[model samples]
Target: MTTTGTTSKQREQATRKTGSQSGQPIVAGVRSDLHTMLLPMFAEQNEIHDLETVIDGCRIRIRSHDAGVRIPTFMDQKIMMLLAAHIRDVIQSGGQPTRHINIDRREVIDLIGGGGSTGGSDYRRVTERLQRLHSTKITAETAISADVSRRRHFSWIDAFEEDILHTDKGKEVIGLKISLSVDAFRWITQGDGFDMTRERFKSITSAQSSCSRIYAICLANLIYAKGEDVYIQIEDLRLRVPSADTLKGFKKRPLSKAIELISASPDMSRYLSVSLVRKTEDGFIPLDGRAPLESVYIRVCKGPDALPSINKLLPLSETGGDTRSLSAAESLVELLTDRGSSAFTDTEMADMS
Candidate 1:
């Protein structure tokens, strides 16, 4: 867990160039299922004690280590993405992939844009986030067979061992040997995932607030979307994000603020366009004071700088003969359509936030 001092050769090995450090397009493999369902939108440290809910007919239960720790937030999502990218690189290089992987702590901080300082405060925070990811447990319902249902229980990480290096300056964490839980490993390495550029991942993780980060994550996951416009009901979105904000508050603040941020980013705007819309008897219309806000209309297409790897991530044939790729929004629409309902009851809405 700790080392007295690192030799020059050791330091060189530790800092050797991975795909990310080489300035190549870092393509991160991310679980669409987990990202679209498990992560919370709000970054507030709210302790979740055996919280259980049903999302899209799948029962999900979340439990933190104790009242002192919270479930994985947007920040942890960034860490998971980084780990996924590392694992992908390992597999592509013909290295045997496993649930356990090694990571350089300093390189991680630099990649996620945490801060320039790798001092005690920063290291402590990073370790705390890792512990939180390891301690929080989740059980989700899955269908094992045509008529059989099963519940899978797992955590983001099973455990981690830290490598502390001692220098004349001070003691520092040089690396980590992290073991991903069974479900987490399967989710990341399996074919049911998406690819994202390293720059986009960093841009989102370093976002100023939870709302902005969550919005960026949602948009980035829409890389596979094949339509000109995709409509998502606001109520359904609120539940998917598991946001604490009510419909009015969510629309006025987080949703609106995210739109503004995305619009201001020239690169982001070129790839994805987002706007508010209202539903009426005729069809979907632009948001105005006249009608109530009902849904968000999203248009996602490959920009000039988009990597070719994105197009190959999800093929229509893989999606069970569906002509268009099923983005998170499209998937939610299908679930809602099957249920014949989109609005949540007052009690259900209150419980979600």
Candidate 2:
């Protein structure tokens, strides 16, 4: 694996050069299936021994390698997103991307919007989050089509090494050298992925509240709905999104707060609209205007501008005509839609909030 680093001067120069470019920021592609199924949007303090849940038809199992290590949190997911953006840049530059990547600590700080300084707290935060990502295990089993089913076992980071230098300055922490698991690498580089603007990504990741971060990701992935509404059971959502709150608490506070934030943000609302609803024998009813909190589902509808262009759907390849590209696109749609399992009647759409 090749290790790379940059001094503060070099970083400044790179930043200036990036700014001088055509003003179009790089777009990162995150694997649709993994984002929706494997990654949890909320943070957790308690150690997770073994967690198993089924989303759509896919069965997911998560475990921590050590008793002390916790599952990857929303912050960890941000790091993964940054890494994915870097990999995309590499591929676009005609460079062969690898699982082992070296990222400067300063770069990570910038991504997380932790300001320019790489203070002790920032250093520890980056290193500890990388360690947690390295220690967690994830296995997902889902059908690709009517006939094909696949099971994959992988971690976010297969290995992590911190670059430290000792000299007249005593000791200097350089950066991080991490090896992404093979599955993770493929997911970013080859799988059916969706494009997210770097600006939008930064906005969501840098939010103060974890709920806002979680809601943004959930809403962003709903672009696959193609301007249609997606109704997910509240219980099912609680299962996928790791939260400390009970189901009732989740519905009352975190979920509501998230809805408020997303609704208020122009960047988020430009692409999707969200609401809470109750499913009944006749149809779905919008829970609005002081309605009592009850068992309800989240209804996410894509906005007019939410669909991706043809170019965004394909992976960054030299020829841009790889056979796997089509399969990837198809797989993404299949996995996210739950293969019709979550489908509802048009009557469920009346008086949508």
In model 1, residue pairs whose N, Cα or C atoms come closer than 3 Å (at least 3 residues apart or on different chains), thus clashing, are 244-353
Q: Summing lDDT over every window of 10 consecutive residues in candidate 2, give the lowest-scoring window.
A: 18-27
Structural similarity to truth (TM-score) of each candidate: 0.71, 0.73
What is the C-alpha lDDT profile of model 2 across 174-281, one tens digit per residue? 545678976566566654455566566566545544455456445544644445677766665665565657888878877887788778877767777788887766
10 residues in a row with least lDDT, candidate 1: 17-26
What are the lDDT scores of the predictions, listed in order?
0.55, 0.61
Q: Which candidate is the best by lDDT?
A: 2
What's model 2's overall lDDT? 0.61
Write the residue-wise lDDT of candidate 1 on 120-234 in tens digits.
Answer: 6766777877877887887666454699875656678889887655576667565577888755665565434455555654564455554454454345334323322444566
| Colliding pairs, model 2 | none
Q: How close to the true structure is residue 322 of candidate 1, measured as C-alpha lDDT? A: 25
Each model's number of backbone clashes? 1, 0
lDDT accuracy of residue 102 in candidate 1: 76
